[model samples]
Every structure is written in C-alpha cells, then in structure tokens.
Target: MLSATPRTSLGREKHRGSTDRNDLYQVLDTGLVCHLGVVADGHPMVVPTCYGRVGDTLYLHGSTGARSLRAADGAEVCVTVTHLDGLVLARSIFSHSVNYRSAVVYGRARLVTDPDERMDGLRALSEQLVPGQWDYARRPSRKELAATAVLALSLEEASVKIRQGAPEDEDEDYALPVWAGVLPLVTAWGKPEPDPVLPEGIETPVHILRRE
Candidate 1:
C-alpha cells in the first residue's frame, strides 16, 4: 500500500486516486519527462526535465550552475509525471475531461555527493533516456563529472491518479443526438536519423534501431 501523507492525499476526485504502489511505479516508469517544482525567491517554479528511477529513488541531474537545481537541493520538492491517453468527450461541456495517468511525489531532495552513487545515478539517467546507451557510450570524465550535479529524492510519498475509458454523460443528455466518444492519443518513436558526420561503414545500433 502507498503511504498517504498530508500532501499526497487527494483533496478532490478521490475516486480517481489509487493507493496501489504498483500503479505509482507504472506511471513513473512509462513517463518520458517529469516536472520538478521548487520554491525559489519566494515563488513556486516548475521545470521540465528528464529523470530516472531506481528502486525507491528518483534521480534528477543538471549542470552544477543551474539555478533551479541549486535552489531545490536539500529542499522540499514536488515531482510529477503525466501521460495523456485520450480526450474524453461528453454531451455537456463541463463533463468533458482527458483520460490520463499521473503521479505526484513530494520529498526533500538531497544532493548526491558520493562519487559511486553519482556515477550510478548518471548511468540510470542515461539508460532511462535510451536503453543500452550507457554501455554503448563512453563514461564521463572527471572534468565532465565535476560540472554536473545530481539530486536524489525518495519515492515513498506519492499520489497516483488515473482517468481511463469513456466519459460519463448525464441520463438526460444521453437521449440527445450529440455524438460523444473518446479520441485516443498514441506516442511512438519515429524513424532514426543518422548523424551526417558518422563513419561511412558505421551502422545504427540495435538498441536505437528497434526503439518503438
């Protein structure tokens, strides 16, 4: 069961909320990007960024000089990942909504200082973005590693909300001639475009060529 902290509890649309830890993992695992929210200069700021999850921890990295990462380090931050599945159409305008799976996590991020953990976190990030790339590419050098910063946040406190299937229309409106159904959305990887300066004999790796 997932923990229900004050911030993780859903205030509204409780029916759509999920308490299953697997559901939370599923949402996070499938998402490509997450929005990290932090308080900077007395104002809330949100940044779109790529992330990687390993077990119960989520890792985020950026340049050491980044203001958002610097300000959010060791502070309470909220990370959210959402996937749009479809557009729900109802007879009434107010009843219309989107079918989506979203997860919000609240925790205090700790800047990763250990060299081993930092390298492992970076590997996780690379593998998450592109499977098998971490092994395919060269490792980071000391100078490059010094310029990057990684933050680790626990996934213990999180909220998962999923809206799926068709829209719910009122009984009175069901008799109306208005058409209503869901318009599904799909996401997939496109054809790979090779680098122009690549060696003539070099071929696309299977990990990238088979991406879908």
Candidate 2:
C-alpha cells in the first residue's frame, strides 16, 4: 500500500482517489514520459523526461550538465504520469471534463553512484523506451557513462486518481437537447523508417515490426 503522507493526500475529488499501490504501478508502467518537479535555485522547475520503474523505485536519467537533474539529486521531488483516456461531453458546458488516469509520487531522489547499479539503471531506462534496442545497440562507453547522470526515487509515497466513463450533468440539464457522450482516445505505434544511409541488406528487427 502507498504511504498516507500529507503530500500524497487528496484535498478534493476524493472519490477519484485510489489508495491501492498497484494502481500507482499501473499508471507509471503504462506511461512513456513523466513530469519531474523540483526546486532549483529557489525556483520551482518542472521538466518532462523519460523514466523507468523497477520494483518500488523510479529511475530518471539525463545529461550530467542539466540543471534540473543536478537539482533533483538528493532533493525532494514530485513526479507525475497521466494518460488521457477520453473526452467527456455533458449537456452543460460546466459539466464537460476528461477521463484520465494519473499518479503523483513524492520522494527524495538520490544520485546513483555504484558502477553496477548505474549500468542496471541505464539498462532499465533503455528497455523502458525501446524493449529490444538495449541489447541490439552498442553499449555505452566509459566516457559516455561518465557524462550521464541517473537518479532513483522511491514510489512508497504516491497517489493515484482515475476518472472514466460519461460525464455527470445536473438533473435540470438532463432535459436539455444537448448531446452527451464520451470520445475515447487511442494511441498506437507507427511504421518504422529505416535510416537512409544504412546498408540496403539490413532490415527492421522482429521486435520493432511486431510491436502493436
């Protein structure tokens, strides 16, 4: 279960809140990018970046020179992932809303230093973005590894909120002639485009072609 921390508590729309830990994992695992919030140079900064999750830990990586990554190391941070499912149309304009699944996590991010763990974290990140590319592509060299920075944040303190189905309209608005329903949104992978300069004999890998 997720910890009931003050930061993770919901002040409104409590009906949409979820305390189940699995819900948090589901939201994070399905998401391809996350917005990381942190205080940098006494100002709030939110950066959109790719991430990976292993067990209860979330790993984020970027260039070592990035200011956001530098500020996040050893500092409290907030990470969020959201998936928009549909647009809910109601009889009244005020009742119009969206269906989405979102998760917010709060924790102190620590910079990974151990060589083996750093490599593992990088692998997790690579796999999260592209399943088979990590093994197929050339591994990072020593100089490349030194130029990258990885931070790990625990998922113990998190909150999840999900909204689905049709929108709710007031009783008086039900009699109105306005149409009401849901427009679902779907995401899919596009066809792979091979590099133009590559040798003609090479072809797209099975893993890339098989992705749905």
Candidate 3:
C-alpha cells in the first residue's frame, strides 16, 4: 500500500488520511462504476463507467466511441469511486448530504499495449461487471484485445472521504422540530439473465450467484 505524496487535500480532520490505498481498492472492488475525470483541451470532463481494481492499479474499460477514453490517453486523469450508505436528513436542508465512501485516484493513464497484460486487464474488467463471467465465457482472441481500449491508473495519488452516521446539525437547529436521522441505502443485484444466443446447458456459476 503506497501513501499519497500529498498532491491534494487529504481530508478535513488530522487523522483523515486514507493513503493506505488498500481501503480504496476495497471500496472500488465493491462498486462497478466510477466517475472518471480528466482534463481535455483545457476543459474538465467527468464520465461515468465501469472499473476494476487489480492490486494497486485501477482498470477502466470503454468502447471506441467514448469521449473519456480519448481524453485519458497520456493524460493525468482522476477516477472517483463512491458508495452511498445512507441519506442524512437533517433539521435543515442545507445540512443534508449523503453518507458515502469515495476515493479519488489520480494518475496519467496509459493505453494498455502489451498483449498479455491487455487480456488480463480485460478479465479484471469483466469480472467486475459479472463475477465469474471471464472464466465462464470464451476468452478474447488477439484481435479482440487489440480493438478494446483499457487504461490502468496507479494508486499512488489517491484519497478517500467518508461521511457516515446521523446528520450534524447546529446546536439550535437540533432543538427545532424536524427529522434528523439516517435513511440507510443499499445496492443489490437481480437475477442473471442469460444471452438469447446461448446454448441451453450453461448456468450461473457460484461466484456470481452467491456474491454478497
């Protein structure tokens, strides 16, 4: 686990530095998509898409038409992975914000060029989408790997910000007649639908069917 080099604000509190990065990896592994931000032609853009973490690197996959993929090539990009655990309904609307665990990873992304590593990256990307899918489905041919674009960003410059529990209201506001508690949020997967072209024998593997 590499610590951040202090390129950005760590956190508001003194002990808020989450530079261990393993925690960030854990959060990223739990979530399938991330809001990837990068500067292109002097403008900032944030694109939402799926991602996967293999050790310290975060891999983002996209199609050829995606604008974010074009901007990420050889550019310093920021990817944010967030999970909303609850909604903090405070006494005042101004004090309201979702309780979330989020990580911002900063690094110049390089388009994966190695043939061997490209397939591995694609596997990680696929597993993130549907666990056990990589092994269950046919592997990509060399030509398929060459067509897909994958970017790997390191965990060197990243930070995590979390807000949990109940809302923080002012002393006077707490006495006011208003609701102030947490409405817990959750994310879950539905039944896996098989492809229409599939042969009848295939079934959902345990990894996908049993994931918590």
Please list the Cα RMSD from the true structure of every candidate, rounded to 1 decimal place.
0.8, 1.0, 2.3
Q: Estimate each model's TM-score.
A: 0.98, 0.97, 0.87
Worst 10-residue lDDT window for candidate 2 reads 1-10
Poorest 10 consecutive residues of model 1 by lDDT?
194-203
Judging by TM-score against the true structure, name the best candidate: 1
- Models ranked on lDDT: 1, 2, 3
lDDT of 1 at 189: 93
Clashing pairs in 3: none
For model 3, state the Cα shift of residue 109 in Å: 0.6
- Candidate 3, residue 9: the lDDT equals 65
Candidate 2 lDDT score relative to the true structure: 0.92
What is the Å distance of residue 21 in model 1 from its true position? 0.9
> All candidates' lDDT scores?
0.93, 0.92, 0.81
Better of 2 and 3 by TM-score: 2
lDDT of 2 by residue, 1-212 (tens): 77877878888898999989889989998888999999998999999999999889999999999999999999999999999999999999899999999999899999999998888889988888888888999999999999999999998889999999988999999999888999999988998998989898898998889865
